[model samples]
Structures are given as C-alpha cells and as structure tokens.
Target: MGAGDDAGKSFVTSGFTGTGGASAQPPSPSPPVAPGKVEGPLKSITPTEISKRHILSKIKRGTPSDVKNTVILPHVDAEADLAAIKNNQGKWLGGNKYEVNGRIWGLEGSGAIYPVRGDGLVEMNKLQYEALKGLITHEGDRDAMAKDKRFSRYKFHTTDEDWNVAQGVYDQR
Candidate 1:
C-alpha cells in the first residue's frame, strides 16, 4: 500500500531475516573438498609429550657414538673413609664414663661413644650431646636411650661435669 509496507514485507521474505515467512529459502550447500595434509592435530600438546618428541627427534638424527663432546667428574676413594669409621666404631676416651647395658665407656674427642650393647656405637657432635643432656641420665637405660630422640641413635650416661665439658666444646665451635 506504501513504500514502508513494501520494505517490511521484503524483509520478512528474505532468508537473512529470521521472521517465519513462506518465501524464505534455505542457504545453498558448499562444494565438498578433501581434507588437507597436516603434520599433526590442531590441539595443544603437553610438556611431557613435547619433551618426548624432541628426544625422539634427537635420537633419530644420531646415536651416542656421534656425540662430539662429554663431561666426567673425578673419582674419589670412599672405601678408606668407610674403613676408618668402621675401625673407630666402639672406641671412646677415659675422662667421663657411661655404663650402657653393663660395660663402661668414656667420652672421647672423636665424636663417638660405644654403648653397653658392644655391637654398635653412637656418633654425635658436642652440640648434640648438650641438647640431649636433659633427656639422658647417668644410668643409660633402654627406655631413656629410646626416648632421647636425638638425630644420632647413640646414647650414653655421663656425669653433669662431662655434660658441661661437652657444652663448652660446642660453645668453642
């Protein structure tokens, strides 16, 4: 009937406009094509997968014999040190004595004391002894030794004077 009415009627018939009109037609289908050649999928890769792929590429390029350079560390004689520790296992000095089980042992400067058990020894620094003095008593009992809870498993019973000496040694350090 008018220019505005014609424009509205044309818009309703056009497929671009979503109005439900009988004149609206579906879009034409696109031409079919083969999938393109690609090295991999478009999805993201994990760090571990990337690292493994990189390592595999390197291996494919060359073997270990093809390596031009390498580094090696100097060797050390650990057996001698271990032998020394084993030899000094149950040795202690005579200044202060602790009786573990039944045998008495003296505290020594070597930082180790033999327990009355005779089979093994406790190794510790002067600072460790000072810290454990409250937990240990002059009588080395299995319960006291077990309860001491110092980093070192070795425990012994010694006098207050010996403990004071140990503390002094720690202070000097």
Candidate 2:
C-alpha cells in the first residue's frame, strides 16, 4: 500500500513501538474495581434527613414550664393574622408590643399572634423577609390555605420566624 493508504488507517499496535505505534490507539478501559469487604456486620442507621425548605431552622425547643415545646407553627402571614386580631376575627393574646425597625410587632401568649424580632422569635434577613412577603401574598397559597387541611393550622408560606414566634407564645404560656 502507499504511504497515504495508512493516513486514514490506524497503525495502532500494542506496546511502545515509536511513531504510529500501539500507543496511538486509545488505552482500553480498566475494569471497575470491586468494593472492599465491609468490616463487621452492617449497623442499622436511622436517617435524619429533613427538607431545608420546609422546616424552620429557628424553631424554639424549650417551654416556660420546663418542658419540651413542640407546638410551634410556621409563619404564613403575620399581617393577615394581625389584621384578623384587629378585626376581631381571632382573639389576640396580647402582651407586650414592640416597635422593631419602625414596625410594630409582638408575640402573644398561646401563640395568638406571631412576634417579631424578639427572644425565641425567628430573625429574618432582608432576603428572607422579602421571600416570605411574596409567598404570603401569593393567591394560590391563600386558596390552598383555605381549602387544604395542612394549611388549616399552618399557612402554606411559613417561615422560621413564624415557627419561632409560635414557640415563643407557647413558652409564654
């Protein structure tokens, strides 16, 4: 054959022959390594995974009565609940009212109203606050909350602050 004949043909051979040698061909893929034998018997492990989106990281744990408080609720809409309290739609467990960042907010006993910027309260950064604000005003979220059983106790747009306020209210009681 002519020199040009090998141009399109592979002269790849095995071993370190020199130009146009076996090394020209791609190396064969090595077989996957088998997993090493596990030492001892496999232990039963419990999974502790939870969704960061749904669960509030700032939820309160301890109660005032020296017990574990688990009645924390997510913050769905503080404005709506506060409005409800003002409109006499819901009872306001009023106690101390606070003006934080020029906004009046408080946590009521029994979690009647979510508190703002206080102990056991979820502190919101600007981004989190804005995100929650959008979520709280979503029409779909409102509709779901009205009809969904899950939303009956907790709103669809809950935040860590909401959970913390609920716990704080429970703690106050």
Candidate 3:
C-alpha cells in the first residue's frame, strides 16, 4: 500500500509478538483468588466508618502511657483475662471487682472501669462493650480526637468478633 493509504489504517497489536491485526485479541485471564472471597468493586464506606477504622487501627496492644487515670490495667495474662471475663470465673476482688492473671477487672456499672487494653481487646459485659464501641463509632476520628482537648487518651480494646458485630450493628443503624 502507498504511504498515504496507510494513514487511515488502524492497526491493533496482539500479545508480546507486536503483530498487527484488524482487531485486538481477548485479554488474558486473571489469577485465581482465595476461596469465599470476591474481587471486584468495593462496597461504599462512610466517613464515619473510615474514621472508626483508622482510630481502631491506630490502637496498639497493651496499656497506653498515661495509665494512671484509666481503668485498663497493665496486661498480666491477656488470654486468661479475656477468658475470665468471658466465663465470669475470676476470683472476686471486692467492690464489684474480679481478678484473673494478676489483672483486676471491674463489673459493668462500677464507675469508669473499662477493662480493656489499648488495642481494643476488651473484657466487659455486652452493655459496656456496646457503649465502648459507640464511643469509637462516635469520636474515632484522628482529627477529632486531636482537636478535642478533653478527649480521653485511653485506647480501649475490643475483640475481633465484638468489633465486627458492633460494626454490623452500626451499619444497620
């Protein structure tokens, strides 16, 4: 064909060979994904969810620096503590308190005794757990936490199951 004739001819490449064709070949298939997992467009997330996730992610295991004012005690036996709280089998420490693995945990309505480590690993009743999650759902934003001068510095803890359940409840609400 003449040089001028090639001007209107649109060529499509096929794979790595770079062979020109009238139409492009079908794209290669993607690798397999894990079981029971879908890879596609993500569900829309709200700003509140994002903020809550960010704040929750920031919380680390163990007590925060300023533990004097908070009820979360230094972790002695986290697993045991969690189990004790879950089973309610800890030794009574008086004043509506329980002790397990050297950690003193308080009952649900005994003042501000949130028996949780910094990373959201909590050992409390359903009501107290919900209330704690509600706080995270509300003021869980980094900017908001920073801006609010009186915001509590204590990073409370919650279990994975609890977090997911709480998030689901919040989503429903």
Q: What does each candidate score in C-alpha RMSD?
A: 40.4, 30.5, 26.4
Report the candidate with higher lDDT, 2 versus 3. Answer: 3
Worst 10 residues of 1 by lDDT: 67-76
Tens-digit lDDT track for model 2 on 10-81? 221112112121112232333432244311111121112211222233322111111111211233223333
Please identify which of the two predictions, 1 or 3, would achieve the higher TM-score against the true structure. 3
True-structure lDDT of candidate 3: 0.32
Question: Against the true structure, whose lDDT is highest?
Answer: 3
Q: How does residue 30 of candidate 3 score in lDDT? A: 28
Q: If ranked by lDDT, best first, what sequence of candidates would result?
A: 3, 2, 1
Note the Cα lDDT for every prediction shown: 0.26, 0.30, 0.32
Q: Which parts of model 1 are misplaced by more than 4 Å?
A: 1-147, 151-156
Candidate 3 lDDT trough over 10 residues, lowest sum = 42-51
lDDT of 3 at 57: 29
TM-scores for all candidates? Answer: 0.15, 0.17, 0.25
The list of candidate 2 runs beyond 4 A from truth reads 1-57, 60-75, 91-173
lDDT of 2 at 130: 32
TM-score of 3: 0.25
How high is the lDDT of residue 162 in model 3? 36
Best-performing candidate as measured by TM-score: 3
lDDT of 1 by residue, 10-69 (tens): 111111122122211232332332244311111121111111111111211122221111
